[model samples]
Target chain A: QKEVEQDPGPLSVPEGAIVSLNCTYSNSAFQYFMWYRQYSRKGPELLMYTYSSGNKEDGRFTAQVDKSSKYISLFIRDSQPSDSATYLCAMTHLRGGFKTIFGAGTRLFVKA
Target chain B: EPEVTQTPSHQVTQMGQEVILRCVPISNHLYFYWYRQILGQKVEFLVSFYNNEISEKSEIFDDQFSVERPDGSNFTLKIRSTKLEDSAMYFCASTLSQGPPLHFGNGTRLTVT
Candidate 1:
């Protein structure tokens, strides 16, 4: 099984709509979860980060992790055209060193 | 806001030719990594460098691939003999510490024909 799995959705949503992106992992040892946004031909940019099994909010972005279910999610509120990008979920174990696993990004298109 | 920077935003090379992708990571960051994303595929971790040594690497980082922190500020990934499958967007990233959010460069899009 892949360590991390995510739906590669070309999800289309109207501007101002809420967006939810998710990923699931099979590794029970993962402790750090992150969300990265990548624009076409650009590198991945860190959008949100969360440690352990809790929720962390920053501005319109919120990241949540559930260690029990090995799931993580990113919620974008009041989405804008600027939010139209590929969202990738990443996770790593606290003691796994520098090897972080990334998911196949979900392509989101926020229509203006 | 300091950010990682990569050179040669795009590269095209013939199979069997050597290629080197360069990066200048955030000055204060200590950990650096190399990742690649093939077209329509997920981003995959290639290797990590710390303290001027390779801390970890994935299976994809084979003998044909190597990394070097030649200087205090510059890090690079060198592929001895490139293959068509080597075509992808190579990204350089760095973090202040373990478990910290990684700051990535704009990436070098490599096309091996």
Candidate 2:
């Protein structure tokens, strides 16, 4: 099985709607979870980061991790057209290593 | 307000030629990394560097690939003999410490013909 799995969603939502993106992993050792935003032809930008199993919120974005279920999510409230981009979920262990694994990004489109 | 920067936003080269992609990481950061993403694939870690040495590298970062911190501010990834399969978007990233969230550069699009 792939270490990390995410839906390659071209998920479309209207402006002002709430959006939820998620990923699941098989590695129980993962302690760092991150969400990255990438526009077409651009590099992935770190948007949200969380350590262990908890919720972290910044402005209109919220990241949640459930170590028990090996699931992680990014929630975007009041989505805007400018929020249209690909969302990638990544995870790594906290042992000072470099084996960060990334999932296939979910493509998002916020319509007018 | 600083960000990682990569040069030669786009590059095209022959399949057998050697190519070097360059980056300048955040000045205060000590950890550097190299990653690549194929057109529609997930971003994959290639290698990580710290204290002028490779801390770790993935299997994909094999004999044909090398990374260097040639100067105080410059980091580079060199592919010994590029292949059509080597075409991808290469990104440079840096972090303040181990396990920190990495900041990534815009990336260099390498197209091998």
Candidate 3:
């Protein structure tokens, strides 16, 4: 199994819809979880970050981590076309340094 | 907000040629990383540098690939001989502290033909 797995979603939704993207990991050692948004041909941009297990909210985006279940999720509320992008879930263990593991991003489309 | 900057937004090189991709990470960041994503594939970590030395690297980062921090400001990745399969988007990233979320540069699109 891959260390981190995310659905390669070409999930389409209308503007103002709630979008929930999720990823599951087989490694319980992962402590730092992050969500990044990438536009076509552009680099991934950090959207939300959380440590261990808990929920973090920032404006229209929320990140949730369930360490016990080895699951993580990013929730987008009232989505906009601007939110159309690939969402990547990344995790890393706090060992020697910060060597990270990434998932195949889920592509999202917020249509107008 | 301070951001990482990369040079030569796009590059095209012939097979067996050497190419150097450059990046300028956030000045105060301590950890630097190199990652690449082949079209339609997941992003893969290449190497990480800290304290002026290579802290860790993946199996994909072989002798043919080398990273250097020549000065306080610039981090570069040099491919000894580019291959057609080496064509991909290379992203440079940095973190303020170890185990923190990494901030990425715009990336350099490298096309090896």
Candidate 4:
């Protein structure tokens, strides 16, 4: 089984809708969780970051991590067309290893 | 805001040819990384560098793949002999310290034919 698993969704939603993207990881050592947004042909852009098991909020985006469950999520509120992109969940162990593992990424489309 | 910059936004090289991908990371950043994503695949880490030395590398980063911080400002990844599977989007990233969010460049799309 892959260390990290995420549905490569082409999830379509209307503008202003709340979107929930999630990922499950099997590695128990993962402590740093991150969410990245990537547009077509562009590099992944860091959207949210959280350490350990907790929730971190920034503007319309919220990142939640549950170490025990080995799950992480990114909640996008008031989604807009401009928000359409691929969302990637990335994590690394707290031992300061730079070897980050990433999910396959979920494709999101916020319609107008 | 400063950002990582990569050169040769797109490259097409013949298989077995040598290719060097270059990146200019944020000036004050202490950590540098190279990652690649094949078509429709998750981004995979290649290697990481700190204090002018390689800190870690993945199995994919073999003898043919090497990284160098040639001038203290420019970080580069060189593939001694490109292969068909080496075609991918190569991203260079940097961060001020460990455990923080990484700032990435637009990426260099490599196509090995």
C-alpha DockQ of every model:
0.78, 0.74, 0.78, 0.75
lDDT of 2 by residue, B22-87 (tens): 999999999999999999999999999999999889999999999999989999999999999999
Residues B4-72 of candidate 3 have per-residue lDDT tens digits of 999889999999999999999999999999999999999899999999889889999998999999999
**Candidate 1, A90: how far from true, in Å?**
0.4
How much lDDT does candidate 4 score? Answer: 0.94
Structural similarity to truth (TM-score) of each candidate: 0.97, 0.98, 0.98, 0.98
Clashing pairs in model 2, backbone N/Cα/C closer than 3 A: none
**TM-score of chain B as predicted in candidate 3:** 0.98
- Using lDDT, give the best candidate's number: 2
Give the per-residue lDDT of model 2 (tens digit) for A1-112.
8999999989999999999999999999998999999999998889989989999999999999999999999999999999999999999985645568999999999999
Tens digits of per-residue lDDT, candidate 3, A1-112, equal 9999999989999999999999999988888999999998888998988989999999999999999899999999999999999999999987765788899999999999
| lDDT of predicted model 2 | 0.94
- Which parts of model 1 have CA positions greater than 4 angstroms off? none
Give the alpha carbon lDDT tens digit for every residue of A1-112 in model 4: 8999999999999999999999999989887899999999998999989989999999999999989899999999999999999999999974644788999999999999
Cα shift from native, residue B13, model 2 (Å): 0.5
Whichever of 3 and 4 has more DockQ, that candidate is 3
Evaluate model 4 with DockQ and give the value: 0.75
Question: Candidate 1: lDDT of A110?
Answer: 97
